[model samples]
Target: MTGYALRKGLTFCRVDGRFVFLDLPRDRYFCLSPIADQAFLDVIAGESPAWVAAALRDGLLRETADDTRPVACIPPAPPRGSLHDNNQIVSRTSVLGALTRRAASRVWLRARPLKAVLDRVQERKSSRAGVELSVAQISRLAASYRRAGMLVSAHDQCLATSLAVAWQLASLGATPHLILGVKLHPFQAHCWVQLGDVVVNDQLDAVRLFTPILVV
Candidate 1:
C-alpha cells in the first residue's frame, strides 16, 4: 500500500470535531474523531500503528456523519472522446445521470410524508425501524447507475454523486450504514460504497472490480 502522505492530491481537515481527508481525482474519503485523527496524523507523521490502533479502539467517537466528511478537491470530468464526433448521440444509461436519478429518487420517495409506513415499521421493530434508507445502499446503487450511465453516454464518474446520495438520505432521517472503499490504481483511485453483504447499484461487479480497504 502507498503511504498516506504519498497519496496525491490528498487534502485534510477537521470536521464536526473529527480529523478527515478527501483524496481527489480518486473517489476515496477517510475520517477520524479528534483523538483518532491525532492518531492517524501521528501514524502518517511516523507514529506506530500498533499503539495508535490500541488507543483508537479503546475509547473514541464511534460514528461520524456523512455531511461532516472532508470535501473533494478535484472534481470529475467527462470521459475521453466525449466531444470527438459530430454524432451527438447521447446515451441514456450514463453513469453520472443514473447516480443523479437514483439519489433524487430516494429524496423524493422519502418526502411523501407517509407517517403510516413509519408507524407500522416502527411498531414491528423499534422507533428506528424504517425511518430511512441506508446511505451505503444508496451509494452502491448510484455507483451501478453511474456505470450504466457512463456506458450510455449519460454521465461520467463524479464523486459528488455519492456525496449527494449520502447527504440526501441522511437529511431524510434515514439510517446511515456506509462502507467506503477506494481503488488506488496506476491512473487514479476511485471510491465505492457498500452495505451489509451487498454492493448497491454497482455499475460493474464491485466484487470483481474494487479492492476494499474496510467493509464498514
Candidate 2:
C-alpha cells in the first residue's frame, strides 16, 4: 500500500514498459496512458506526479495508510525450459468424470459474478493445504481434462475448465495455481492452471501468449 494505491479489486503490472491494469470488479483489462503510467510510478515512489490528483478523482488510486504493495507484482510466467507437455493415457471414465465436473463449474460460474467466482476460488485455494504434484501426475490430469474439453460447447470455456482443474487438483492435495492473464492489441483474457512452471490444463505456448495479471 502506497500513499495512493490502486482501488480495491484492482491490480496492475508492467509489460513492455507500459502498465497493464486488471479491473477485477468490472471484469475488464486495460492499459494506462504513458503519462498516467508514469504518474502511478511516481505516486508509488512517494513523489506525487502531475496526474496523481486526477487519478484519485478517477477512483483509480486510493489513499493508503502504509506502503507495501509493489507497482508490479505477480508470479513469474511459465519458464521457457519448463516441462510443457507429457505423454499420458486417459481412461474413458476419467474423461467422463472431467466432463461432468467441468460442466458443473461452468454452471457455477454462470450463476455468479466474475469477482464472486474468483473470490470463491481464492478462498478454496487458501483453505486447502495442497501438495506439490509430480510432473507425471500433472500430465495425466491435464490430458484427461483436455480430452473432456473437446466435448465442451463454448469457446469461452477456459475460465471454467481451469477453475475446475485447479479445484480438482487442490482436493487431491496438489497445489496448483489458477492464473488469469490478459493480452493487449486485440485485448483478450484467459485463464489456466499450472504447478510451478508446468502448465496443468493448457499448453505452455498457448498461455504464454498472455501476461499473468493474477495468480490464485
Candidate 3:
C-alpha cells in the first residue's frame, strides 16, 4: 500500500543475500533483521507488504511517493581476483605529496561536514573530464600512497589514507572511486580506491574479504 526509500543520508546495498546500509554521517553500517530485510525486499520488488510497518519503526526506511521504485545503490565491485601492485619505486617527493594530501583530507574531514567533503569527491569525479590514467600510472599512484600511509603515526585506520589516495589520483586527472566495503561475521569496514576492475590501493587477497557497500 506504500513505497519507501532509504532514510535521508543512508545508502542502500545488497551484499551476500542481505541488505546493508551505510550511514556516512554516523560512520556506521546498518544491517536488517530477517523480517525487515524480507519486507524491504518485497517493497523493492514492487509489492506492498503489510510487514513494512515494522521496518518503518526501525527507522532505516522512509515514506516515498507510491510510484517511486527503490533500488539498490550498486557500486563497482573491487577486482577481488586481481592482485594489487606494490612494485613501483616510491620517491620522497611522492611521499611528501601524498602526506600533504592526507593532511588536507584529515583537516577537511574535521573542519567541514562529511557530506560537504564527500561532495568535493563527487565534484572531482564528475567535473574532471579529459583526465585519463593508464594502468601503470594508477599503480604508481597507489604505491606512493601506500608508502606514505606506512609512515603515518596513526594506527591502521584506513579512512584518511584511502581518501588521500583517491584525492591524489583525482588531482592527477584520474577520477578514482573511493570504495566503502563491509563484512558481517566479525563486522568490519574498509575503504580503498579503484579504477574499473583494477583495485589501486590494497591487495586483492585482502580486498576480497569485504563486499563493497558504497562507492564515491
lDDT of each: 0.39, 0.77, 0.75
Clash list (residue pairs), candidate 2 = 1-67, 1-68, 1-69, 131-173
Ranking by lDDT: 2, 3, 1
User: How high a TM-score does candidate 2 get?
Assistant: 0.87
Q: How big is the positional error of residue 167 in model 3, measured in Å on the Cα after superposition? A: 1.2
What TM-score do all the candidates reach, one by one?
A: 0.32, 0.87, 0.85
Ranking of predictions according to TM-score: 2, 3, 1
lDDT value, candidate 1, whole model: 0.39
Candidate 3's residue-wise lDDT over 26-103, tens digit each?
Answer: 866788788878878888888878876766786766888676657777778448433245678878998788788878
Deviating ranges (above 4 Å) for candidate 1: 1-155, 176-180, 184-187, 212-216
| Residue 93 lDDT, candidate 1, scale 0-100 | 44
Q: What are the per-residue Cα lDDT tens digits for candidate 2 across 1-216?
A: 456667888887676677888888897778887787787777767786768778879998777787643465477645453333455887999888888889989899878878898787777777775577676777778878877866665368989888889888877777678888877776788888877677777776888888788888
Q: Write the per-residue lDDT of candidate 1 for residues 1-216, one digit (tens) a residue.
A: 222232334454443344445443343465555565666655645444544445435422122323222232322221221111122333444445555655564454355432332233234333333564554445544445545444544333323343344333444445323333344333233443333343333333443333333211
Q: Backbone clashes per model, in order?
A: 16, 4, 0
Q: Looking at model 3, which ten-residue stretch has the lowest summed lDDT?
A: 77-86
Off by over 4 Å in 2: 67-70, 80-85
Model 1's TM-score against the true structure: 0.32
Highest TM-score model number: 2
